[model samples]
Target: MSTFRSHVWSSVGKKMITGLTGLLLVGFVAVHLLGNLTLFIPDRGHAFNAYAYFLEHAVHGWLILAFEAGLLAVFGFHIVAAVTVAWTDKRRARPVGYALVRNAGGKSRKGLPSTSMIVTGLTLAVFVVLHVKMFKFADHPSVVYDGKEMKDLYAVVVAAFKQPLIAGAYVAVMGMLGFHLRHGFWSAFQSLGWNNDRAMGPLQNLARVVSVLFAAGFLALPLYILFFVDPSVSGGHR
Candidate 1:
């Protein structure tokens, strides 16, 4: 048990755990973006509301709660592992502790995304909490869909986006998400021992492409709602 515990806290073990959990989160982000795409359907939230309904009532809601629990666990694991790895790296770089240091490597892979990961990750953590609170738990006008009254999440989304401040903040965080994934997507593979000299370049490029797509996709809804769509009429309710 001591050996196992020591291995889990070791640098390599931390990287492996962080990488795996990061990939899982990447999957979640993709599926979530797909579901959010229903907002663009012109049926005035009918499609989106139905999507929301299915997710909520799936398996009598137990499945969703279970999934949320699992996701939370994964997130907690990823954060702790990543933070510890970063802290260890920082300390190892300057063992004398917080003293002025010069550049140590000309071949360093360090970049904005890699260096700022902790910052962006914690920021996104806060964003996630507020996002869930605003959309999932908050009360909003209800609309009947197929004779079943449901929360007009679409209305809430539209109203929220119409506010410039909220919309801008969302866009900014999504940009941060893009930056995080730009490094995370490929580095996760590298950490998992799947990278080679030949494959690394392509993987990095793919990560950038995916990051841009995700950032743009999320930005579209808010920008569209803020500028083009009328919140008063779009959600099929006031």
Candidate 2:
């Protein structure tokens, strides 16, 4: 009886952590997307830079650091748990690879969506590191670009997008991220015991909508810079 209770508690504990962490990540992504959207305002590079500067150096700097640390921990745990869950399921159903295998248990097969989640997560991680290096770490040198001695954030953004491959990569990764979140959001809610038949149905639909909106919002910045913005201005600073 004690062992049974322990096992039940452990499973519940893991699910609780997973659900909470997923919710935390969702909040972070929503706020990050909102901030990214600020770049869309024409000739507001200073505004965006100021916003970034506040996040990095304001009185709330320590708070942001704490939140980032928490996010990192949650992401690490989520990945570890996801891998563990996937491996365990695979082992339980060790079957030969067939052209098609269906699980009637309402579980998604190991297919494009699953593969894309892993791949895009990795790709986005790489992009994030590069993004920080290019934007955040770039020194603010006074340069005479279009009679402006400010940091050439506009140039940096345009230069990065000029590479068609990178722009396409961003779009692809964002698409995959949408798919991943479409399933993940509702799953997280369900795990947290918000799974009433009536409520869950509408919530699932809402999750899909929200996920696509988020993906579109994040993807728009690169697309705008790559396609619409005039690169010649400020030496390709969009």
Clashes of each: 0, 2
Give the C-alpha miss distance for residue 84 in model 2, angstroms: 1.4
Residue-wise lDDT of candidate 1 within 1-238, one digit each (tens)?
9999997777777888888999999999999999999988888888998898889999999988998999999999999998888888887854211111222222467799988999999999999999889877887788886678888888888888999999999999999999999999988886666766677679989999999999999989899889987765765543
lDDT for each of the candidates? Answer: 0.84, 0.65
lDDT of 2 by residue, 1-238 (tens): 9987664345444555556677788888899888877678776355555556567665657967886688778888776655554455458655222111222234443455545665665565676677668776777533333444445565666667777888888787788778778777766665567655566678779877988898999788788888887766533232
Q: What is residue 70's positional error in candidate 2, in angstroms?
A: 1.7
Off by over 4 Å in 2: 1-12, 94-116, 136-154, 234-238
lDDT of 1 at 7: 75
The prediction achieving the highest lDDT against the true structure is 1
Q: What TM-score number comes out for model 2? A: 0.76
Per-candidate RMSD, Å = 4.5, 6.2
